[model samples]
Target: MDLKPYANYLRAGSAMIAGLAIGLLATVLSLNAGYGFNSLRAGPWTSWPHIGGADIDPYARAVISRSGEAPLGRDQGLAFIARTDSDGAPLDGACDYRIVDPLPAARYWTMTLASPDGRLVANPTERYGYSSVDILRKEGGAFDIDIAREARPGNWLSPGQAQRFVVMLRLYDTPLDIDSTPDPNSFPKIVKLGCA
Candidate 1:
């Protein structure tokens, strides 16, 4: 007798339910894609694509390295590689690190420590980077940079806690090939000196 009204109500309800389901599915797919891309790009096995014969890790390499390149050109080259402890996990933050390396031909080089979440460590001072320009020279022309929570007498970086930290290496005016093939050994290593 009143079938028309009932049918109209049913159709409207069905349409609303269908729209909600579609929206939920789209959201889930978007999130999955984002996480998947990030995982692959940041994973240890990933390598940078070849650009002008440069063997850089395009995704994880510092933003500064892409200067004059499309899209990311105005970005800073500040790529970080996580340092692990003897157990192969991330090193504790409260400990100090003696980061050392032989001088390179580039005009400048720097080592910066960042929290696991990619933010600068929250130390009393707002310092983050240790550059060759500021670090004291050592025997055999090598440089020793200290990273700890407290300020040291010489070149010091801040590692706010004893959890996970990343060390970013920046080499200005470095050859394209050098950027392409970043030597793992050249990066800073986290050696546990003591607790803060």
Candidate 2:
């Protein structure tokens, strides 16, 4: 007796549970997608320009939280990230690269090589990055850094066994508006050479 009402209630509860599960799965997948996190794009680089700031969106927050990466607010500075070369090819340790960076508007900046998971890639050189102060510049403040699986003459970053990697440029105590787009010529360029 009254089995019909009980069955109807069970059906509704199951449907609600299934909907919640599917929604949660989709949310997680979207957030973890490849560099698809909420960010601003400039040329080949992308950055969560407002990270660690009040302007950060929910997706950016989730990404920062999950990655455990501490970012500086606008007043502090900003970060620009590049995972591809000037030709839009993903950077590989098997290939050699030349990163030409002109004088950025920031007060101080550092270029570092990191694995996709954000950890510094290991190498015999034990060189992971070059800070503005340490870089050897040509006549002007512009400089070129070498990136490869092998050692280079100067300002070199060796990714070691890491098959793929990302280059991150962090500007600290900067006064420039990093969130805004700038002339492509103003930013650095990553050129890939032959791969081994």
**Candidate 1 similarity to native, TM-score:** 0.54
Model 1 lDDT tens row, 1-196: 7698899999999999999999988755653331122221222212222322334333333332333332112122233344564235456776776765643346666667776544677766677887767777766667677877778876787766536776655555544242344554544444557666
lDDT of 1 at 138: 69
Instruction: For residue 120, give model 2's deviation from the true position in Å.
Output: 0.9
Task: List TM-score per model, in order.
Answer: 0.54, 0.86
Candidate 2 matches the true fold with a TM-score of 0.86
Report the Cα lDDT for residue 66, model 1: 30
User: Each prediction's Cα lDDT score?
Assistant: 0.54, 0.80
Who wins the TM-score comparison? Answer: 2
Tens-digit lDDT string for candidate 2 (123-177)? 8878889998999887755689988776678678888999999999887886655
